[model samples]
Target: MAQRFGGKYSPSGQKPEKGTPSAGPMNTARVTPVGLRANLMFVPAGVLLLSSVFSGAGAMALGLIGAGVWTGGAVMLREGLKAEAAYNDRKVARRPALPRKILAAVLAAVGAALAALSAGSEPLLTPLYALAVGGLHLAAFGMDPLKNKGTEGLDAFQSSRVARIVDEAEAHLASMADAVKRARDRQVEARVEQFQATVRTMARTVEEDPRDLTAARKYLTVYLLGARDATVKFADIYARSQDAQARADYLALLDDLQSNFATKTETLLIEDRSDLGIEIDVLRERLEREGVHLDRNL
Candidate 1:
């Protein structure tokens, strides 16, 4: 009798052909207001450079200096925006140590002042142009984060430990991605990305409850490092041979790792919920003992 094809043993989704990897649409679109502004800055920078060609030595030097300072400001603004995005994504985060936006504004104002002075503008006009440019820049980009988020009353030592572990884990993930790129196989890339998603799930769970760090330390450190090394070795081997059996084995290993990571994250969440329930029960008992009747209906 022939075995039926629709059960646990069967492939669940549309499977790709052997040795052919599935590819998804790339997410190339991004919201980059700072980046757009930075690009637009090149227009003014080019104008300054052109102006320098027709001016005296003093003016030429000042024009070049102005262009350099303005360019630096644009670069700083872009980095500040990126840092802001990362800060916003986390439940707990530290504000950027340096105020990049403010510094950029200062640099832009100084650049404008230098240019005005070089062009033989009246002293009064030079200061006015500088102040106007600086004020406009401040208005356009606003300010950097001034306060830490969700860090009140938390244990500082524990938070720092969690941050260190997460940073190391992120490095491992980045290394894996870099190694996999050398293999030039879409399927391998997809396999790595799927595993990364599982890793991120676990990371988020830990972030929600830093107490879970004790339970998840090995998974975050040792296992991730091992995976990174394996990815590097696989990329080297596959680049030269493209061995089908090796590729299959690597992919199967990724599947197992992803499953385990996902399961561990779910377990941590369940435990957290159970702890919350116990706390609620204890609070209710205390309230009842104090003769405080709870109202079930509003």
Candidate 2:
């Protein structure tokens, strides 16, 4: 049969590849050949010829043998495209494709060889002919396991082993994520401790020297600013927080601070630092603000 299976058509309305939804009649959009099964006909064809040589192969074998060449060619072309796609896909990802492409290439070569044998004129060729075809098919199929791209033959034992490895890796990642969260929590605690220290320092300054309201007031400002920073951090961590009591406590504290920060400290002659964006140190103003009074016990 004179059959032209694949040919390029630059003419208008010609489908670019097979398997395309827009391809016109005859599934012309399907790529010429691209897939694992592309040249798979060699497998059955070689089996047919080899079996026929020994035990008078049945009609099934004959049918498979007749279509072997074209089938293999078609499959190889398609799968070869698949291999190409795999290769192109790795350009940006840097993913290695030696395993899969090698497997696919091995299969393609077997199919090509089987198709090549068809050119010969013989109902059943010499022993080597069928043996070559059969041997190659066996080798090509063997590529699946040898390449280790797919675990088709892995027994239950091997499957369990792989599963264990995956589980262990996931556990390790989870542990690391937990450790990061703990460290972050610790940092927040440190900030809270520092702010509390500033408040205590403010109180002590007033006790040490009743007239040193300037130093005491500066310390209070520091405490307020520190508290504002802590509030922001708490908001970040507690976004979707479900703890009712904790949420209430934080909200109450925020409201109290916001109220205090909005008003000016009469004796200090300055707005509370928390209500403002940043602290500005004014030596003259600090010394002049005598109206501010800090009681150590308060």
Candidate 3:
């Protein structure tokens, strides 16, 4: 499959053959192996690979070995077939090298090699078997923890539409700042500058990882906290301005707060959390302390 540009997939740039139909793979980070390939190949292959136990004398040991070989072989064939099918389907120019297939092929080939090597020294096959089996078990167990370390759910959502969101967000910030500056009021201009700086920080953080979105989230927390502070400071200075301009500055403070909240909403689209409540409470308390009452919902 074609790789994502940002945090999402796009199979958009393609022309299927006249008689061909395209069934794209799940275009997300958490893609499950699906269709027949997953059921027959991935499931069985895993079971068989884990069945490699060599502790018994004859019958049990032989059975376990047979089970392992059967499952491993089947998985390799099935997954390999899946790859071949993908190639045939024109969905992928090359098949992905799943770890299970490589492991199975290695184990099978190594078994043959060890058998030949231990021909005269039959007793030596015991250590060889234990080593191969134990090594694969360790390898399999290690894969999950390592792969799960990246930003959660971000891979599916980042490249979702890079150019569009990036442009939209930046343009919105610029447009709003222009609106403030064009009003030709010093207090409004000052608040707008503070707001734009926070936005720039958020944008920089989001763009840092087109592949990983957690960084963007971190930036948002910083941005919101800073925004909350700015609102309080603006409210304090509001009493000093003339009546109409003071209300304008308060309205401008609301505008800045709105921008912060909107940015947070966009960030939350790719990440989910409950940390926003604390920031809201902080903003509310500061607003009340400054005697600048305003509805803080949305």
TM-score of 1: 0.80
lDDT of 2 by residue, 19-104 (tens): 11222343211243243454455455565455445533354344345445435444544554554443342211112334443444
Q: How many residue pairs clash in each candidate at the backbone level?
A: 0, 20, 5
lDDT of every model, 2 decimals: 0.82, 0.40, 0.46
Which of the predicted structures, 1 or 2, would earn the higher TM-score when compared with the native? Answer: 1
Using Cα atoms with residue i matched to residue i, what is each candidate's TM-score against the true structure? 0.80, 0.19, 0.25
Local accuracy of candidate 1 as per-residue lDDT tens digits, 1-298: 9955653345774456443434556432234445666667567767888898899998999999998898898888787877787677678767888988888888889889988988888988988999999999889887888998887876778877877888799789989999999999976887787788778778867876888999898999999999999899999999999988778878877877888899899999999999998988888888989998776452
Q: Spell out the clash pairs found in candidate 3.
A: 6-159, 7-158, 7-159, 8-159, 8-160
lDDT of 3 by residue, 185-237 (tens): 55455545555555544444454445324545443444544544554454455
The residue pairs that clash in candidate 1, if any, are none
Question: TM-score for model 2?
Answer: 0.19
Q: List runs of model 1 lying over 4 Å from the truth.
A: 1-14, 17-34, 293-298
CA lDDT for candidate 2: 0.40
Worst 10 residues of 3 by lDDT: 141-150
Q: What are the runs in model 2 whose C-alpha is more than 4 Å off?
A: 1-63, 66-73, 94-298
Better of 1 and 3 by TM-score: 1
Q: Cα deviation in Å at residue 288, candidate 3?
A: 54
